[model samples]
Target: MTIQKIIRLLGRFFRPISLKWRLVWRLVVLQVILLTLMIFILLGGLTIAGVIPDNYEGRAIDVIRNTITKDGSGNLMLKQGPLLAELRKEVPNLWFIAKDEHGHELSEGTVPPEFKHITEALDYIGDARFVAEPGGSRTTATVQWAEDTAAGKVQIFTGAQGEFHIMALVSVTPELFLEIILPVGGVMAVATLLVIPLVVRSAFRGLRQAAVLAERIDIDERGVRLPVERIPSEIAPLVRAVNGALDRLDKGYERHKRFLIDAAHELRTPVAILNTRITSLPPTPERARLLQDTARLSTLTDQLLDIQRLGRQAQQFTRFDLVAVARGVVVDLAPMAFAAGYEMSFEPARGELFANGDRTAVERAITNLVQNAIEHGGNAGRITIAVNSPATIEVSDEGDGVPAAEREKIFEPFYRLRPRGHGAGLGLNLVHEIMQIHGGRIELAGSDRKGACFRLVFAQA
Candidate 1:
């Protein structure tokens, strides 16, 4: 595959792993690079310290081969100059005995008497190394043949006293890395990898605690702060900034809530007075419409007040009979349903069906559903509030049900299926929030029969 595809695949594979693994991965990669660089560094250091031999052998061989030139009459000769002098410095105690296929021999340095008979035996081969202890002294040397343009195949028998040679380092590199460095590095890597999790967990404790606190900070639970003590300075700023932002958000939310509560309170007096005036008018189609508008306005004002009050309500969830709550709501709205030319009824279960929640909040949620149905359920059909088994209260109307497309959006604040619908649209949203607070949910229970069905599934006691 392409490099881009490989990178994408790697990204996808690693994305799901936590921060600990990512950090570990980066450290491991860095370790590999460090070890690779260490290989060459170790080689160079050992060769410099005379631990490995013949590191500069290639340069020595080239110098000796290139410097072997003819002196006018075309005789094999080892020319002496700065090049040979530099070779002596690199391979200290250097000596060579060169011979050709034509029986010509040119010797340099103190020709060890031990190698005199060995040179004839090495004539059959092009390259070889000999390590012998002659008269209690370890003698090491290399016998190699080089092809020269002027001189036919020159056999070079070379040796050095010191071990500083590039050839020896090159020869020992594979064994050094594979046998010594590889095993040692592998053990080090394994031990580091095994210990990394503990280090990471300890280091990230503050972050984990912060994440947990952040998760629990819902709309109601304001003023919650993440732990910043013992956090690394690099990440402390981000944590403090988040805390500051949350403080500002909480203050802004409180201000908005105060404005809504004050506006609702202020609107009640004027709305009541308007209703009184509209009711006193002579019975007519216009008066009826005005009264309806004023009633909707009053409901909206009450809903706004409910929002503020519920925000401050300390939740004390208890098991209560859902049947009674449903029946009470149906009885309360029976008069309104009757006045609106619709039949209202309650279907309570045979036994007390218990659900865990704030009783007052549950009642309000049920009331909102019934009220919603009455206002928008075509005003000419029956509205049923049924308390079923398994801690549920379902409110369904025998009118045109909510459209399939608008079902999800209806629970959102200020969303109305009809633009001119007689609702401030806070009713369903308020109920939804109530369910969320109770650790339950409100679901749109679609029915094969006509009309919309809204079900409130409460938490088990």
Candidate 2:
């Protein structure tokens, strides 16, 4: 299929679709929100990791200063490695680098080559006897130790005139990255992964129920409502709105049905009176007049009944021969055509002119259509009725065609195409009702010829 065709097909599926689509959009929104939150959290963690190491190293450097002492010759001495060794106790995993006045290495520990630059940078700023520069992989931090023998660390030992330079690099181990951050991230990811689907599933559960309920509700079954109690609290208001709409539809259907029944009942009295008066009269001019009125009244009554019945039986239809049904109605109404001084023709539709519909109802609907044409259509015109295919039926009258603008309104109840002096205008309305019941629609064709053509197209199952 072409892209346009595919889009049209999908558009049909999405058109007026209810809660499920909204829920799907909501799920996407939630995923975006969760992802944003995760990004913020990871950035915060990295920042904290950077800050903690600097604080830890500063404290370690302070402890190292306090650990060394001065000799009688004013030369610095390690009274005991205890002060330096205490780092192994304080921060169990430690790396240290110390230098004397001549830029000589005094001690080496667990600090990696990556950390050396950081230590030198630190010393340049502190103007201390020793400087520490840090280096490592981009994600990991390391410190490099350098001595500022003239200042900070060396100046602090001026009391004894001893030159002492010590620097250290201390870092949380790779184990800390594994144990702390990895496990935390893993836990968060697993929790998020597990909860997100459930949250999304739970969020959409009400929409699913709404969809199922909507599917079960046909035009005939308007009163059915979805259960609101089991739905999530957040969706309850929406459910209530849907149920309210269904309630209104049910009420409207009932009102329309009652109105049709009442109208049909009221019309039946005048029709019955006309028939009785016709039978009572002697075989004279009065009797003929009564009979003609009775026939017209009877036809009007049948059309009204057909309209009512179409509405009531809308839900009940089965596969049937549409051509056979149309043909039968044409034969039945043929006599009326002859009496009206018009010619009636039926085009025998080829192949299986089968449609899913009520056979009796289709016949009655067609009969009303044909009879209307014969009555209102000019005396010399031809009335043609045909079931052209499994999906379509056409009825055309070669009289002055209905005006283009009025064609659609002609299907409305009691809307006459001609002036008020003509036949009762219920024929097209009744046809419209019947077509609606059969899940089909009727259209007024634009013909170049001077005639009106009505086409009924049934929807495919």
Could you say which candidate leads in lDDT?
1
**Whole-model Cα lDDT of every candidate shown, in order:** 0.81, 0.64
Which residue runs does candidate 1 get wrong by more than 4 Å? Answer: 1-22, 32-92, 95-159, 162-171, 218-220, 282-284, 312-319
Q: Model 2, stretches more than 4 Å misplaced?
A: 1-146, 149-198, 208-221, 227-230, 248-252, 278-300, 311-320, 350-354, 458-461
lDDT of 1 by residue, 1-461 (tens): 99999999999987787878888877777786788678878767865654554445456667778888556765778678999887777666677777778767777677567766676776676698776676766566778889863576788877756554456566777887798778877876786788887898999888988998999887888989988996777899999999999999999999999999999999999999999998999999999999989988999999889878775344566778888878888788899899988998788776688877788888999999998888788988889888876778899998889887888799998888778988899999999988887778899876576998899987777
lDDT of 2 by residue, 16-115 (tens): 8445545555655565556545644554465454432234355555554565444565545554676556655555555555544434333434544544
> What 10-residue stretch in candidate 2 is worst by lDDT?
157-166
